[model samples]
Target: MSPLRPEELQALLHAAVDDLRPAPDGYERIRAGIDRRRRWRVPAYAAGGAVLAALAALAFFAISPRSHTEVVEPASPVTGQLGSGALAPTASRTASPPVIGPALSPSLSSKGGPTGATATGSATPSTPAPAGSPTVTPTRRAENSSPATVAKDGDIDGDGVVDPDISYNGTALVVTLSHNHQTRAVTLAGVVTPLHYTVTDLDDDGRGEILVEVSGAGGVTTYDVVRLQPDGSLRALSKGPLPLVVGASSSSGAGFSCSGGLVQVRSGTSDDGTTYQVTTTSWRLSGVTFAPVGKATTTSYDTTSSAADPFTARCGTL
Candidate 1:
């Protein structure tokens, strides 16, 4: 027989141990020894495993840059893309380009100096100002240097008959018409009270209206405008009074000269040798009532020949 290997010897010893009885004193001692050894070996093996695991963890941390510490940042809308706030550069970060439509080039300066493009690139053509440059806005000249000239007709009341006493008072033009054995007075007002006026259909309204210059009374000699109503009434339609002026003297003459819608009241002595007192008053007709509007006092002294001229005679109103 050849010499037995270590395996044969170990198998023979295991068979002998297996054949031993459990109640034997030697068996009990051997079992206690095996249990003690197993307890010690288990603790040693567990300690060794713990040390190995610790070493592996240390190696992992050393090898990887971001292994030990984790950094949490705000999540971005795009998947897997880092936000600008997360990886900002040390040098203070700036706002990102706006994600709008196509980017536009910088606008060219409209200053008087040459443009940057002309200096660097080709010269650009410039449009010249047109010859006799058209006026951006044209101004309109005033209608007439003075107010429109109104035509005068003797028939002021539209009756087609001339009345000698009908006239304009600068504020109102009055025409006295005799109809059906009763005298009826008609007056018309105008925007401007002319120095002299003649009756004409100003607005083509068939009815006659008077044009008179409205003037202020005392120190601040300013003129305004007014119109005459068809019923022989005075109406002030402007910011100031009519252009009628009153003389200082007490004895003055007053008379009315009418042409169409235009009427003028002259209250003063003519070229004849006479002194007269003229009291001219204005009133507005409200229904049947005549309301006092304004009053003026004028006196006229005739230094010429003493001939009794009806043209220069004093007149009155009832």
Candidate 2:
């Protein structure tokens, strides 16, 4: 081996020294990278803290109870219709209209028997009805010595002839007796008028009785029985503006007739070419009162054709 020159030896020494120098500042680069990551972590940590605070605030309000306050409003008025075809305005409950009908009297009785119209010039004689026709039997009442006794063939004054005169005084009916020349006035209450009269032998005693029919409100008719006294006086046998039939409360007109010791009441009602009804009530005299014995009713309707629809019902002895 030859001895190395100084320059070559120095060059080899410099190369070895260059190779031995520390790797280019690796710890400084790692420290710079760590500093950059710390900067980004600060912002992320701040955003995460803000989001947690917002979530806590939302949870706190969601569980709170709400207020319960009532809001009341006033009721308004309303127009309502009643059962009787009337309209009423009210603030609360609607009112019901009054019922339109005749009041039944306690003194009168309803019974059944054969029916016949009173003898009238316009009335046609009908065949004797079968048993159980609309008729009422009278109840016996105690007899009294009244001037006008309710019996057939009664001449209270012992007069053989039965004569009585009737006249109207606007508000009442004036009855004049022939035997004693006595006069009696009968007045009606509330829109009632004396219509006409009929005579019949009610008790079959050969004496004549008078039946007076009067018109009243709502097209209702009333009947009154009067006996002719021998002393020229009149006695009322029954108290009645009685209804015509069992089911009829009102009527446009009424007719009465006495035959075979029975009195019959007939009433008829008609609508405007649409419907019609007819009813008959039979009554018998007992003492001073006439009792209903039988009743019959018939109803008819008009269809689109010429034929009429009819319905009929009978009750009591009829």
Candidate 3:
């Protein structure tokens, strides 16, 4: 349809308002409107089809497949809470650093070897681990208290030769010997328990002897001596002149002694019922036996209750 010229539009407007009362500035308003349309409105309406075509082209381009994709990289790991001071995002995977524990010192393993640490992160050998070397410690404490032990290994016989080892483990039934390797022992009968043992050169001889104390009847300790023979065997020495084996020493000082470079035994009695006469008998080593050597007597006469020298001194002069 053809757009109307200014004159035609004016004529139509006048006819429309013919019987209406004109406004004070209504004609001026009409004149201004016509001028505006002549400059802008007429051109816009005439080219309406071109304007619509241009808009359609722009819309097609906007919806077309894009050359590059808008890839939003993932937000970095949040080391801290939202409100907390968060470290700035970084491209590195490790971010800050691994939370490594303090370095630990080498510790002893059960077999007394240094236990080494293992690779953790990425299996790097020297990488500080989340936990360093194990903080384990091996205790070197003795858990069990040992029983009494007796072991003396050297020249055990008077001959200038070393023989089997001799040892007594307190209450054991046998005396442990090293060479025969515990094959020889003093399995004394009627024995309760072994109390103690001694090893020394008993006769001023170059060899050593074993003095064993065995518990006897009524808890009385019987002391016995044994020698290691040159034949690698043991022989119980007949206690020279003393009563069958008993005691380190009698209550009255009657016991065995090698104090004078000779093996001897002492025996004594208060003779009278009231301790008037003290007769002490003595013996010296005779070959492999002990024979009586004479006796010494001590007499107390003044009092009926009686008096006598101590048993130890009874044989002191002899």
The TM-score leader among the candidates is 2
The alpha-carbon lDDT assigned to residue 213 of candidate 2 equals 50
| lDDT score for candidate 3 against the true structure | 0.37
TM-score of each: 0.19, 0.35, 0.34
- What 10-residue stretch in candidate 1 is worst by lDDT? 92-101
Local accuracy by lDDT, each model: 0.32, 0.40, 0.37
Q: What would the TM-score be for candidate 1 when compared with the true structure?
A: 0.19
lDDT of 1 at 143: 18
Give per-residue CA lDDT, model 3, range 15-74, as digits (tens): 998879768899899999999888997779869967888889999877664432222222
- Runs with alpha carbons beyond 4 Å of true place in candidate 2: 1-164, 169-172, 180-195, 229-233, 237-254, 267-277, 294-318
Worst 10 residues of 3 by lDDT: 105-114
lDDT of candidate 1 over 1-318, digit per residue (tens): 899999999999999898766665887899999999998998999999999999999998676543112222221121111112221221111111111111111111111111111101111112233343221211111212112222112222332222223334544444343111123333344423333322233232232233333343432222222233454343443321133332323333333333223223445543333554443444332322334455554543343547432222121100
lDDT for each residue of candidate 2 in 57-168, tens digit (9 for 90 to 100): 8887676533222221222222222123221122111111001111110110111100111111111112333333322111121122232222222122212222223455
